[model samples]
Target chain A: MKLYDLELSGNCYKVRLFAALAKIDLEIVPVDFLDGAHKREPVISLNPWGELPVLVDGEVILRDSQAILVYLARRYAGQAWWPEGAAQQGEVMQWLSVASNEVQHGPNAVRLVDKFGYEIDKPQAMRLTDRILGLLESHLSSHDWLALGRPTIADMAVFPYVALCHEGGVDLSPYQALDQWFNRIKGLDHYISMPGL
Target chain B: MKLYDLELSGNCYKVRLFAALAKIDLEIVPVDFLDGAHKREPVISLNPWGELPVLVDGEVILRDSQAILVYLARRYAGQAWWPEGAAQQGEVMQWLSVASNEVQHGPNAVRLVDKFGYEIDKPQAMRLTDRILGLLESHLSSHDWLALGRPTIADMAVFPYVALCHEGGVDLSPYQALDQWFNRIKGLDHYISMPGL
Candidate 1:
């Protein structure tokens, strides 16, 4: 299995972190993101979106980090990471949607602006970050995991960006519950760290 | 099954469209968006996000439309709409992430601005819309569907927003391939139409 990786990207980190915890062997093929290699040839051929963290296992080529997590969890990690049954899967997927949308727009956008010098509305990004973090803090205040009362792909999908919120210039001091949740995920067996985390 | 729906929301319509095609019996409970019903009470209790298109089936309560589609497809429509196995599910999920992120930020944001007078950067929304639509057009130029070479939840997840791009002031005339793909989805068995379509 090969993963098109970027060391600093939280999206890429999500897959790497999951692969480590799940004990799945993956060949990390670093993309020359700074030189726009992802936007060019071979990468574009694999994903029309031209995004990093593309996972190629045999005939399966997945682009989105959330989707890659889904594939990895379902195929290799068994039902522990991504549970079966429609309801539980849907519950886990709700967080994946949040990870893709709210988490991406909020913490991820801010990170791009602060870390990578991307032109984005910083104020709006911070607002969105606070909004999502506030929700996470509230949810984590009473629960240990994002879905199904267990650590599923929901945590894997949302963990990276939220843990890297500081790099995005978003303060995590107010989110005590979220802070503890982050630590809990960090303590997981075989957990790996990315640049910011 | 009960679906918390808003007639004009593309997110809600995605579920409705999928349920109609899949022939799942869903009781549509219209949320009074104008009266702030979605943001209040029972809705918030079901989903902390307080977003519409919440599906309540027995013990399950799903908040996101993409997640709801997953639940409905897996539970009722079998593997045809969502597909099984690792790679096929990931292929379908890649577009679900797109629907949650790019489509939500692009065409959905523009529509919120133009139709509902929401405060959002129209230029940014249009740029995002153009970027995604251009990619979709290029992909559809060769393949008949977004994933699996068949009409899966990938098509349903992205269909509503792209089809409603005109409401967001996005002209779809230039993308001949995208138009054909949209028409093909429209011609699917048991397909239903929303307000914009």
Candidate 2:
């Protein structure tokens, strides 16, 4: 399996981190993100959206980090990572939407603005970050994992950007339960780290 | 099953539309969205996010429109709406992420700005709408559906906002393939319409 990757991207790190935990051998092909290589030629052909972290497994080429996590967990990691049944999968999927929407617009957007100099509203990003963190803290206060009382792709999907919220100038010190949840993920077997974390 | 619904929300309409297509009897408990009811006691108690279209079936209370779609499809509509196997689910999920991210920020964001008088960057929303619509047009040019060669939750998840793009003052007349895809969805059995559509 080949993953088109970027060193600092939380989205790319999501796929990489999950692969490590599941012990899947994945070849990382670094994209020249600084030179806009992702927007041109081969990478763009693989995913017209020109996004990072495109996974090519034989004929199955997938984009979006959350979607790739679903693919990896379901195809290789048995029911532990993603699980079976409607309610459980739906539970896992809620966090994936949060990852793509709340987490993306919050910490991820702020990180892009501060760390990478992307133009966006920093105040709005910070506000969203605080709001989502509060939600996560409340949820984690009663539950150990995001879904199914175990480590699932729900945890994997929402972990990266939230873990790296400091890079966006958002403090994690107040969210103790959320911080504990982050530590739990970090303590898992075969846990991996990206640049910010 | 009960759906905590708002009449104008595309996300809520997604569940309503899908339930109609699947022949599932859903009770619509209308939320007073205009009066900030969703952010208050009982509604906020159900979903910490306080978002509309919360599905309550027995002990399972699912939030997020995309997640609700997964739950309803897997439980009620069988594998046709969600499908089985990793590749097919992953294919469907790719567009789910697009719905949560691209569609949410693109057409949906613009619609909120124009139709509801929300404060947001109109130019940025239009640009995103154009970009995503272009991608959708290219994909729909040869394929009848968004994923797995048939109607799936992928189409349902993405259909509402795109169909309502005109409410955002974004023109869709130029994207013929995308328009055709919208018409195809409109012609589906038991398909229902929301306010903008």
Candidate 3:
């Protein structure tokens, strides 16, 4: 499988991190994001969204990190990461929606503004960040993992931007449970790291 | 099954519309959104996000309309709505992310500001709306459905807000393909409608 990747992108890292954790071999084809390569020929053709981390597995081509995680987990990683049961999938899926929506608008958006010079509403991003971090702290304070009582793709999907929150000038120190949860993920076998993480 | 719904909410309508099309019974418990009932007990207890369309199917409770759709399609509606294959799920999952993120930020946010008196960035929402609509129109111009060569939850997840875009001051007349797609969805076996749609 070929993964059009960018090492600095937390979205791409979501896919890369999960692939590493699951010990799935991926041919990482790094995109020159700074030079606008993502909006160019190959990348844009594969995914018209002009986004990074597009996956191509023979006849199948997919975009969105969460979707790629679902594809990889179901096809290669077994039912452990993405379960078969309906309720179980729903439990994990709620977090996936959070990863795509809240986490993207919150920590990820803030980081885009601060670290990458993207023109975004910093105040609004911070407000979203604060709310999501509080929710994460409250949830992680009681539960060890995001879903299935184990480390699934749910954790991987929400982990990158949050771990890189410091890059956005958001402090992780106040979130004790979040800190501990990060450590737990770092302690997992085959765990990988990106630059800001 | 119980659906804690707000009649005017597109998020809630996503679930209700799916249930109607799939012939799944749901006890629609209307929440008083104008009176702040969603932020209070019962709804808040089920989904700490204080969001509408909280589903309670026996012991399994779920938040996020996309997740709810997945649960319903997987459990009750069968594989036709949500396929079992990895690539198929990923294809549908991409649109689910779009529903939760882009569509929510675009048409939904615009409507929240225009119709519900919400404080939001209308310019930013319009920019997002333009981009997503262009993409949707382009995609739908060729394919009849969102994924798997047939109508799936991907179409359901994205339909409500886009259908109600006029309330947000969005002009949908230019997007002929989207109009046709809307008609296609409305032509489904047991189609249902809500207030604005």
Candidate 4:
């Protein structure tokens, strides 16, 4: 399988982190954002969204980092990375939605705003980040992982973006439970690092 | 199950629609948002995010409309509504993410802004709606449904807010494919209407 990867993006890191944890081998193709490789159709014909990481296995082309992680988990069962039952599976979906919306806009958005040199809407970003962190902290306080009593794709999808949210100028000190949860995910058998910008 | 509902809410409508389609009976409980009921606890205790359509199934307090849809789909699987398999399933997640993010900001957000008499950011909202509608049009051009051959949770999760994009003053004439797709979903066996403000 081949993955169109961006080293600094948490979304891209999700796919890599999942691949690493699952011990799956993928040939990584660098999509140089600075060089405008993403906009170039020769590369982007694989996925029109023009986002990374795009996973290509045979004829299937999947976009959205969360979608890719779900794909990986389902394609290879016994990874214990996906929920087996319905309620737990729903929790996985719930967290994925949260990761994309709340996490994307919260700490992740703050970080993106900083990285892209975009003006930060300080009050909105802070409130959103605090709300999301509070949710994460409260949930983590009672649970070892995000959902399903074990490490699942939900955590794989949410953790990277949130763990690195401090880059957005949001302090992590308040979410001690979340901080501990992050460390537990790091202690996984095979883990990869993001080359932060 | 007791559903906390708000008539004009797309999120709330999606859950009710799912319940209707799945034939899972729910005890409907209206939340008077105009009366500041959202500020009250127990309700706030269900979802700190303070969104509508919090499903209290015995003890499981599920927030986030998309998550609730997923939970219903998985928890009651033998039904005809939920998508099956990886590619189709990934497609479900993809549309779910789009509905939560792009749809949330474009149609859903605009709807809220207008209904609540908030100032309109016409240029920004128009751009977002156009981008989203364009993508939706492209997806619907070839496929009959959002993520599955049949109408699945993906369509159920997204259709309510998206079809009402015009409620937010978004022009829908350009999206022929999506318009047809909307009609198709509305043509479902147990289609329900979204209440006006």
Please give the distance, in angstroms, between residue A56's alpha carbon in candidate 2 and its true position after superposition: 0.8
Q: For model 3, what is the alpha-carbon lDDT of residue A47?
A: 95
Residue range A111-156, candidate 1, lDDT tens digits: 9998899887778788888899989999899999999887888999
Give each model's clash number: 0, 0, 0, 0
How would you encode candidate 4's per-residue C-alpha lDDT over A55-80 as one tens digit per residue? Answer: 88887788888888877787765538
Candidate 4: tens digits of C-alpha lDDT, residues B8-111: 88889888887887788889899999887876887898877777878888767788888888778777756366555666667677878887777876787677
Q: How high is the lDDT of residue B123 in model 3?
A: 87
What docking grade applies to model 1? high
In terms of TM-score, how similar is model 4 to the real structure?
0.93
> What TM-scores does chain A show, candidate by candidate in order?
0.98, 0.98, 0.99, 0.94
Query: Which window of ten consecutive residues has the lowest lDDT sum in model 2 chain A?
Result: A119-128
The TM-score measured for candidate 2 stands at 0.98
DockQ values per model? 0.85, 0.81, 0.85, 0.59
- By lDDT, the best candidate is 3
lDDT of 1 at B3: 94
Runs of candidate 2 exceeding 4 Å displacement: none
Minimal lDDT window, size 10, model 1 chain B: B118-127
Query: lDDT tens digits, residues B87-122, model 3?
Result: 999999999999988999898888988998888778
Ranking by lDDT: 3, 2, 1, 4
Tell me the lDDT of model 4 at A67.
80
Q: Is the docking of candidate 2 incorrect, acceptable, medium or high quality?
A: high
TM-score of 3: 0.99
Candidate 1 lDDT, tens digit per residue, B8-63?
99999999999899899999999998898999988879877878988888878889
Q: Positional deviation of A150 in candidate 2, in angstroms? A: 1.3
